[model samples]
Target: MKRRDILKLAALAGASAVVPGVLSEVRAGPIGHTGPYWITIQAGWGWDPTLFCDPKGAPVNATYDKAQIAKAGNIPYAPSNENDAFFGKYASRLCVVNGIELSTHQIEAAFRQMWTGALEPGYPSLAALLAAGLGGGAPMPLISAGGFEETAGLVPRTRLVGAQPLDWASLTAPSADMASLFSPMTETRIAQYRRERLKAKLATSLPPGIKSVIEAAEAAELSRPKLEQWKAHWPSPLSDDPSRALIQLTLAAFKAKLSVSANLWWMLDPAVTDAAQVENFNDWTARFDVLMDEIEAFGLDNSVILVASSGGGRTPMYLDEQMKGHWSVGSMLLLGPGIPGNRIIGGTDENLRGLPLDPSTLEPNPTGVRLRPAHIHRALRRLAGIEASAEAKAFPLDAEDLPLFS
Candidate 1:
């Protein structure tokens, strides 16, 4: 495909999710990495606990029954009727944390707290932090499928699919006409110009954020081969669900040994919840099961950290027996290496209200403080072994440590 045609296609997509970096010469080597991939699966909008994680507290006459609550060793999960497929495959490895309130009623605030740990600016999403910490020398350390993802520090984001995925594919391959543009003399001149421009740009006083962008631009100029490497491993059948497609892309990156973390999201449409809750969660969990299978097959199971979270929790089953607005509490699931499996943390009243949990014990503590995104942030920092570093420490968790987890 022609390079202009690719750009045209990308332009047609309305908005662009630009991959951060410069776009000039080809990169010399494939981006590879050791183990330990941190991945976050977003159960966005508001999630129904009865349908997936907190079924135990659902009303006695709700859509899901207590009998459906299954135990695989020590894990107690209340999956919707249609979610047997997901629970069946992942129950053993799952660690379900309940009654942890995100402690916010506002949607936007909830979103910021869920991913970034704090309500303040300059602190990027957990995915960005992990990518920076885990991806030592990779150009694209962080990858996102659209969430509260940001580069708080000097790290760069990679929107490979961008405004148009098909156009992105073209970037991985250069047609004969496109290749002809790169001649020896032209390459030398362009490289020299870039160096000079970079030096001049550096000499000027620029904000840290702008400086990072400039640096990313320089890196992008030389990421052609890396993009091509990604294109070569792109999954076929990309899938109708954007999140699943991201899963494929993330898995492909892992198999190619390129990145350490990727973020994904799933939606909870309130209007459709009354009728489609069962089908929705069944599909979501099933896709997650597929991800687990792929990770295990890659022999990186112990090196991977899988986190499932959301911005809000759904209201109780009411009049029509469907979930409604956001609640102060929600659920989070953590699986993968070093994380204890088959355990449930925190608790709620029998009526499904979220209560605080002692971070140190991972148990309910009304007298203690409520758990927020910042607390999870710190615990995760400890779990991933980056809590002590200056970068990781810069974004401290709001609550205290959950020693039981460590």
Candidate 2:
């Protein structure tokens, strides 16, 4: 294809999903990874548990009565949105964990705690850790559209939101008419000279920091071609919807073996407002349903482990009679072939405090510990079979190991 045509296609479809640093140059055929892909979709801004997977009654939420709560198999969900349809379709595949107690209800702290199992900044997100821990040969390893961009420098962090048109003219050749400015023989000499200079510099003593940078540059050069090869798998006629576009690009990377885990974000429509909270949440669920369909269509339903959650939970009561404030207790939904679904672990009291669950039974145990993101992360590391990996050990989550997936 003409380089211009490729740039035009990327611009029109927002191909911001491309890998960076080492993801430039010539194109080749796809490279595929076969099993156990990881995806985490987090709802930006706090979401209301009373209106989502964890339904509460009366003074908690005057919007819906407790009597209106509905059940899908063993799960009880708020009657808002297309809950009946959504839950009916995936309840058997879902492991809903309510009452996630956070150390703080503030947005930033909550986000850090929610995904990294750390209350402090600087920890890599679960997505990053998983990609670094379990990643085997994927070029990008971890990609994020939005939500917890930190990778703790453990893996290459690729973002699928700001891909710009490359200077293909300069990249491929000096001009459109010519493939190269020099003959193949001259090109070979030039390459040898460049390598000799790089090797000579490396052989000399240098500052530790500069030496590391030079070594990293060499690694980047080596990985560039693999990233280029992944271009053959980019979806044609990309979807216009942002959410769908993100999913499409992510799946393409997954199928091409360029990435192992991705973090995507969605938010309640700001225009929907509190008066239409139901509509906002409905929109969220509909997108999730579409995600489910997209995965299944790619024949990845069985291989993808999905986690859907919010940065934090909104309080049941409205603040300033306009909107809900952050609540310390939140919830998360896990689904995949690996987890036994149709299970509800943990709970919240009427006042919206997290109730503890017995570590052994995963049942409500007032005397037991409240479920936290650390616990979930610990369980997730085990579930992905990477708890013992050096990557996991380097950035540890000092959390109690719980049998969350059983």
Global lDDT of each candidate:
0.65, 0.74
Worst 10 residues of 2 by lDDT: 19-28
lDDT of 1 by residue, 121-234 (tens): 678788888877766457556666766777775466655434444445444442324457788677667666876797689779999888866665565655645765654555
Point to the candidate with the largest TM-score. 2
**Which candidate leads in lDDT?**
2
Clashing pairs in 2: none
Please give the clash total of every predicted structure, in order. Answer: 8, 0
How far residue 3's Cα lies from its native spot in candidate 2, in Å, is 2.6
For candidate 1, what is the total of clashing residue pairs?
8
Task: Report the error of model 1 at residue 170, Å.
Answer: 5.9
